[model samples]
Target chain A: MKYFLYGGCSLEAGGKNYMVSLEPVCKALGMEFEEIEDWNCCGASISYAGANELSIMTLNARNIAIAESTGGYDIVAPCSSCYIQLVKTNHELKEDAELRNKINVILKEGNLNFKGSLNVRHLMDVLYNDGGIDKIKSTAVRPLKGLKVAGYVGCQTVRPYGEYDSVERPKVHDLLLKAIGADPVPFPKKMQCCGSGIFLTELDRCLGLVKEILDDAIANGAQLISTVCPMCALNLEMYQDKVNAKFGTNFNMPVVYLTQLMAVAFGMDLKKEAALDYCVIPPEGIIKAAIGG
Target chain B: MAGNYDPSFAKEVFDNVDSGEEIKMCMQCGICAGSCPLRHEMDYPPRQIFTLIRAGRRDEVMNSKAIKLCTSCYRCKVRCPRGIPVIDVMHGLAHYGIKKGIIPRKGTAAFGGEFWKMIYNIGRIDEKTLPLKYNLLEGLVPGIKSTIEMAPMGIQMFLHHRMKLLPERKIKGIKELRKMLDKAKEMGKGGAN
Candidate 1:
């Protein structure tokens, strides 16, 4: 289970904890990994929306080439946006020879070339598909102890590449919750978009969208929402205050990374320094309760 | 309304916009609008936008804030009965809107410009600096005011150790990155080839 990891800008900045929690969890699961050297931003939704397709494509292609240069180990990108961009580059490069040629020309400037030989998979997919749920369950000595969680599968990672799970009705995360002995709460709006990247542009509209997802999770008795995407977690968790301020709703649900909860469920030793106080609705109470405070 | 409509507009879209040809497949199911997270904020919704495109409301569609407002969430694309690439259409119209100097929404393009500068100049988007630059785009007074309003969150992020007084440095061989990007831009004159 050795794969070279590619942590794009989000993990480099906002999603630092994702790596912190993931490293040990993977180590516990017998997964060996290393970070790719000198990788650039994956150009997220912002780049795709703002720049031309070729530019964003090239941005990811260059990174893929970097991984290829490192003996072409499978690249496991934790962030959904990074995963999408890199996988998309591979998909497009494989499908379109003209695109491959153009991207190769650009890569030649950087003394690299995109061979599209590297396999790109999201960390979530690898955890479920490669790591095996039963193995994870065996280590799940400490369950969530009836913590009700909603599994949110954001758009990019699922659609266009339904690699590990169904795009519309993804149940893998639900299975993950059950494996950890937590109650998997049904969210009708599971596949809905979280209105990411539009926060700065249209705050009112963006918060409205977040409001729907949050209210749904709260209504369905989700003590916390488990998500695979970093942007989804950040947007859902951090914007609760402002969303409540705008919409006048009393929704306060904690959003946890799927990996983080896996660490907790497996009873793997998570250092306190890795515990972030940034979650507006801290899972500490529930986590303590689940682990028996 | 009929007099203001340009008969050539829809044809122009098929000719110009990337994947605009698929807009013709839209059956007016309104699923796109129904699935949209920002549907309430939209004046026409995506279905109606297609209607306007077919009806040759070029100016109306281009000048409308809806084009730039799409978050590229892809809820519409995934759920669309007609398989229209809603996000691409939205971005196409946005790029087209920006190209035509029709920025109906404020701060979005400016924020995008600032973001591009940060990513181009440095390899990463430094959280500490991105907002400052974005706020200052409005003007000194409002920028400071917005920064002040966001101060608590800033402090929280600081406490969370999400920030540093110093910004992120450029990636190694950024000059080559710049060259690749310049070539990308030259190649990016049109959308996806």
Candidate 2:
């Protein structure tokens, strides 16, 4: 199967490894990634919050135009915020004629067109649902034997429109871990909001919320966390220091993309896809224990 | 804060915000507020914001940082007994606040301005440029000081290949994209599209 990859802004910056690790892993599973040409930022919350709904929709629709120009429908975005922005725009433009017309007029000025034919997808949706867990098992040369992971899907990917999964409680991510020979820890707060960007505006509240999520993972005996969103991964990985400084806690959880683990399970060499070095807390010892030297 | 309420505020929300008309369905259950992860930081949580709107507290709702600080998490909307689109209303309030010549939160407002400017211009955000411009928005001294303070993280990011020292190049069709965005700005206030 083929998918158009929308890396969003974070992928080029905070999520370079996500883009780095995704390509080889997907190829191993016989999946193709065609990057959307000249794709712009998804106008994440802060950017969109400043603009009116029409302007927001038009900007997202422009991305749809780029993706559609690639002559593909299934466009996969690794960042949940980007996935939501594109998918939500796809849904709205398909349903609202006024929105569709407005976006088309804007596209006309740029000499492009949007037909609302593109299907927006998060990478996990394609990996587990579309590609099927059976394929992941077939591609696995090394199972994640000793790893205990908590799957953090966050709120954006599941809300409003989760085509192939549940919003309140998703099971596919956990199912992916189980298929890969890892222990999928039971986490009640898996779908909870991690305060998203409130970290920028309200530090105290953001810390409290992030601490609650990490505490749940720790209490559940998770060695590390698996994430689908770049922002969620960053909040879990980068904020551990600040969170520790403020609360005097001794939590040292390593956050990683699900694909990184998938790559490990598929027997990809650490040299080819070493995610621990990219993580804020080096999970080298934990990774060694899971996959061995 | 009394007698400062605009009776027309509720109608304005109903008319302007997406699913804002559903504000009347809110029963003060505190579900939205309780579900919010940042409710502690909100001056008027969703339920109270709805009540204040009904009470016509124009200044309160408009000026509250809650609107601007909303993280767009969508927990309240999913759990709302009234099925209110809480995030949309919050965002609408934010845009409305900006339209009313209100500066909700200067730091985030600056971040938003810089982000939009980058996206509108180059079709991509230059991670290095964004923070540099954002910190420097206050002026040279503070900008350099903050930049120095952030040097550690910046170096870390550089090592990780997250922050490229070189500016990101514009996309091939950036001129076309700008034309559309520029036209959008002209229509922003009228919102007629």
Candidate 3:
């Protein structure tokens, strides 16, 4: 099966480890990830916050148009925000003609028209739904047995419109965990916001929010936290020291991209998995445990 | 925890904002209320609060224990099958009460107030002072034994160059931050009246 790989701002900005790993994983599973040519930012959080009608929806709609133009029915966005925006815009345009007309007028400047022909799925959905957990299990050279993981859904992936799955009580991550032969610990704050975009100005609020989520996860017996969004990975990993200091708690949860987890489960080399360079807690020991090295 | 109550303010706030998901859509399966860790302690769980907010019982809603106990964990927001934005609405109500100084501080809310005060005043957060604020705000002091126990980890972080003695940079745009705070305060007061 051919799938168009779409990695919005995060991949464009040289955070290519996720995209790089995902491509190989797809290929190994007998799938082709055709990179979308000349894709731009999906206008992410700012576009949607600024203008609901034109700026955000149209910006994402254009990307959908680009995918449709490629004649690829399945557009897999690795970035959670991009996935949410793309899926949301597609859902809106299909149901609302007035919205479609307004967005189409904005897109006319670039000669792009979005008729919502393509399906926008998050990497998680694609892996779990299209490829199936059984395929992932079959390809696992290194099963991640005895590893307890906290499936961090982050905000946009699950919430707001319930496009991909239910926001509050999502199961995609849990299914992914089981597929990789790991235990998915049930935590109360699985779908909590990791204070991604707001971390810069709202440091304390961000720390407080993340601390609660991490604390809840740890309290529920998770050894590591896996997220689908790079921003979520960055925030949850890099800010551990600050969060620990502020909350006076020992939160040593290692944050990693879901692709990294899958890579380890597939028995890929730890170095090749890019586990050494994470800004937050190191995952070498965890990878070793996963690989039984 | 005693404070003057105004029933209309909560109602007014709820009515003014877009009820993103209709509260009546709530099946009241108690998923959200049950999922919330703070629900048992709360006089009104999230479901009841939604009802009160929709009914426009502003003052009682503001003064309720539910608002004070909310950890903003997004558990209720996630667990609600009806897809109600419970956290946003609860936060809006809490912010309204907090700005008006109508709600008595408790748990994380009190910690948050002091945390903000320290940041706004010094333009930085000092890690050492955090424990004091956390303990005081939460109304419990870590015994000497617990403090002694935590000393090693604190030293290790500092030694590893992870914990900075001072902020990397003094926060820029204090004027803008203050202006935003003032605007928020104004909005809170406006909602109250």
Candidate 4:
């Protein structure tokens, strides 16, 4: 399938390893991504405080028009926030003609227009739906062989859309985990908020939220948490020390991107393909034990 | 509370805020508050905020940190029995608050201002610069103190190569982007048309 990538700001900076590991995983799955030229920030969840609906929508509308200008290939946003903004734009524009016309008028300033002809997808959705579980399993050279994983879906991936999976009880991430031969533990807080960008502003409150999610995952006996969203991965991985500091909990759990685990299972290099060293809370020891490298 | 009430506040919200009309559907169900991950942090939960809007508690609603503190988790949106897009309304209130020059939460407002300005100016964000700029919003002394507080993480990220020391280049289409954004703001000047 033709796919154009919209790697949001986090993937370019803080979550660079996510994009690194995703490369090999997609290649192994025969998925090719061409980066969308001159794509702007999705405005993310923070846009709500700073911009009105029309402005944020116009920001994403530019991206949609950019993709349409080129073959209109399906846009795959690795970040959950980017996916939501893009999809929200498409959903809103398709439903509201007056809004679409207004946005189109704004787009004319950029010498572009939004036709809403293509699909805006999260990489997790693209992997689970387009690349079937069995296909992923077949390509795995070395399956994980029942390493306990908490498949954290985070918020925006399944919520509000719920097209491919149940919003309340998402299982696609777990299903994908199972395909790689990892045992997905019954993680009740899998869909819980990780506080996203709020971490930077409200440190204490955000840490409280992160603490609960980590506490739940650890309680369920997860060796490591496999996540899809960049913001989720960054928050869950980087804030563990702070959570432990504030909450006085002795917790040291590894947080891995879903693609990183797939990279290991597919028998790819740990340092090169998986980019395991970049992780804040490294999973190398547990990962090595799982695959017996 | 009576001193701060304005009877037309509800209608103003309904007409101006994004998805603000949907607040009318909220039946005072506390499911939104119960579902909120940061309910403790909020001065008034989503349910109470809606009731405040209807009660014409304009200043209380706008000045409360509840609206600006939303994490956008979509938990309330998914679980609401009334199908209220709670996240949107909360964010809409936040945007409306800022537009009216009432900052409910200083830190959130400061960070969001820098974030949006970065995006608007360059069409993309330089993660390293965003926090630095946000810290400096209060002045150089506070900025230095805040930056010092975050120095450890910054150094760690720099070591890990997660943050670039060099300035980020503007996108090729930044001019066009600015034009579109200028027009969007102009059209939205009359408030939520």
Candidate 5:
């Protein structure tokens, strides 16, 4: 089936290395990616805080309208924030006509209209539901037998309003991790915030918030923390030294984007995949140590 | 250190709190407390904090070190069987206490509080001035050693064009941001006890 690949601002800004790999993987799996034509920022974190309900809803609604206009019901967003915001706006618009009307007025500025006729899904949800774990198992060229991976869902992916998975204890990421043949490490802080949204502004608080989550992953015996969001990956990777210095604790957990790990499990070349270039703590040494590559 | 406190203070805090979830639904199973990393360091663990709040110890609850230690990780809130949103209530109380100067500012420990102020005062965070600002407010040295150590990284970051001195590239929504901050500050101050 043809899907509208909703690569939001993070992807547009070249922040999502995972999305780069995901494009090929999806194509190989017989799924066609039709990018939403000329989509703007979902307003990311700022839109929710800055605008009224209608403005934010309509802004996201415009993108949904574009996808619907293409006759594409499934809009697969690789970015967790984009998926959450688009889905949330869709739900709100569908439930509240007054909100929908108000947002439509704003969309009129750009000569666009939103009828709320699309389903926004995270890449994880689409893969797990449509293709299923069996498809993943069948496609595995190499098995991730020994690697212990902690699946981090983050706040936006599975919470605030629970539509995708269990809000309190999400296992969608874990299911995806296992589907790729990696051992999913069970940790209580899976759905915690990585503090990346406010990291640029609130350095200490962000560091503290991330450190707590990372420590929990390490304590739970996770060798690497795998996440879907680039910000979460960047925060967890780039800020390790800062967190170590601030907390006076040794936490050497490497952060990998979920796609990177999946690619690795799929037997994609480590150097060709460019996983080592993106990692703050190189995965080569760890992978070599783990599997004797 | 203030032992002379009203017993109903915690109750008042609890009563005034809008957890957005039912507090009575808590099973008091200590899963929240057990799972909390800051539990050992807290004077009142998550369970005790709940108990004290339920007991109406408003002043004690507001002024407790327990609230200060919370990283707002939502571990307790997530793990709570009843889904009490304990972190939300704690955040409210912590904000209340900080405004009234009941809780001494413990530098970067109160990073959330300082963040609100920084955003409110300046349109955006000035990355060049952040180290000095953070160090001074946190009672740590904004010393030469730290700067020297950071220099290579900073220079590399600059060379790579990763770091920006001024935050606002084109002053996107600066006026609206100012107005929003003003409104937020007014609301925060007006809501204080």
Candidate 6:
């Protein structure tokens, strides 16, 4: 299967490792990625700041128009924020004719038009739905049998427009891990918010939220946390020391992208495919111990 | 902060804020507040904010930190018994607050402004430059102080190659994207600048 890839902004820098790990995982799953040419930011960063609904819709409309002009491929966004922005724009445009007309009017200035004929999917959804559990199991060369992992789906991956899994309690992420032979622990806070960009603004409060999630995962015997969103992975992994300092608790949890764990199971190169070195907290020891690397 | 109620404020919100009319469906259920991760830091939880909007507490609602504290978690929206799209309402309130020149949180406003500006310029964000611009929004002194404060983690990220030192390149269709964005702003009835 082939899909249009929207890397978004984070994937270029903060989430580079996710981009690195995605290639091998997709290759192993028999999926091909075709990037949407000249795609702009999904306008998620400004959604809450000062952007009106029309402004955001117009930005994403241009992208959809670009993809539509190329082919009829579904757009796959690895970043949850991008997924929400694209999905929400597609849904709104399809639902409201007036809104669609307004967005297309804006798009006309760019010599483009939005037809809203594409499906916007999160990367996790593509893996869980398109790449079935059996396919994932078959692709795995080394099954991670005894490793306990907390599947952190974060907020935007499944919420708002959750077609593939439960909004309140998603199991697709966990099930995928189980298929790879990893034990997904009972994490009550799996769907909890990691404060996203709020960690940049409200540091102290964001740390509190991150602390609860890490505490829950660790309490439930999660040796490492597997996450779907780069923002969540950053907040959970990068904020451990901050959470420790504020709450007077030490947390050394290893947060990783879900695809990285899949790479390990597929026996792909740890340095090239998994990009484990990019992690703030080293997960190599636990991962190696589990898979007997 | 009391007795300054203006009945027109709620109407303005209903007509102006995106999905603001959905606030009428709110039934005072505290589910949104209960589900909010930042409730402790908020002056008024979502339900109370909705009540204040209806009560015509314009200044109180506009100045409240509750609206800006939302991180787009979607927990409130998903769990809302009324399906009111609480997250949208909150974000709409935040956007409206900015339009009306009422910034409840300086850091959030600064970060969002810088982010939007970068996207407008190159049609993409440069991670290395975004923080530098955001930090300097408060002037060189505070910017330097904050940058220094974050040096440890910044160094860690740099070492891990999570951030690039080189400047980000503009997209091939940046001019086209800019024209669209400019038209979007020109046609804005109250949209972002």
Error of 2 at A195 (Å): 3.1
TM-score of each: 0.93, 0.94, 0.63, 0.97, 0.65, 0.97
lDDT of 2 by residue, A130-156 (tens): 768898888877888868999887988
Error of 4 at A268 (Å): 0.8
Report the error of model 5 at residue A15, Å.
Answer: 3.2
TM-score of 6: 0.97
Cα RMSDs, all models: 2.4, 2.2, 9.8, 1.6, 6.9, 1.5
Classify candidate 6 by CAPRI docking class.
medium
Give one clash count per candidate, in the order shown. 0, 2, 8, 0, 8, 0
Q: Tell me the lDDT of model 1 at A67.
A: 79
Candidate 4 per-residue C-alpha lDDT over A48-140 given as tens digits, one digit per residue, 9 for 90 to 100:
677787899999999989989998578898898898889889888988899999999999999998887988888988899888898999988
lDDT of 3 by residue, A220-289 (tens): 8888888888667667876777787888887777877777778777776655554444323677787677
Worst 10 residues of 2 chain B by lDDT: B184-193
The model with the greater lDDT, 2 or 6, is: 6
Q: Between 1 and 2, whose DockQ is larger?
A: 2
The 10-residue segment of model 5 chain B with minimum total lDDT is B183-192
lDDT (0 to 1) per candidate: 0.78, 0.79, 0.64, 0.87, 0.63, 0.87
lDDT of 4 at A226: 93
Better-scoring candidate (DockQ), 3 or 4 = 4
Error of 5 at A259 (Å): 1.1
Candidate 2, residues B1-193, lDDT tens digits: the string is 5587577888887776655677878889998898887787788898898889899988888889887777777788778877777887777777776766787687777777778888878888787777789889989999999788667767776776656566798888788887887666555544632
DockQ of each model against the real complex?
A: 0.53, 0.57, 0.05, 0.73, 0.08, 0.73
- Badly placed stretches (over 4 Å) of model 5 are A12-14, A289-292, B1-193
Local accuracy of candidate 5 as per-residue lDDT tens digits, A1-293: 78898876455322445765676566656678888775545545432222223333444676787677778458888877677668777887889897677666555555566787778888877777786778777776666776788899886676445566787788888988887778888788887677645564456767887888888898888888888876677678767788888989887787777777767666776645524444556666766564457
Which runs of model 1 end up more than 4 angstroms from their true locations?
Answer: A270-280, B4-16, B21-29, B189-193
lDDT by residue for model 6 over A1-293, one digit each (tens)?
98999988888888989999998899789899999988888877445584766677787888989999999999999999899888988988989998889888888887888888899999988998898999999988888888999999898999787878899878999999998899999999998889987788889888988999999998999999999888998899988888998999989999999999999899888888999999989999999998887
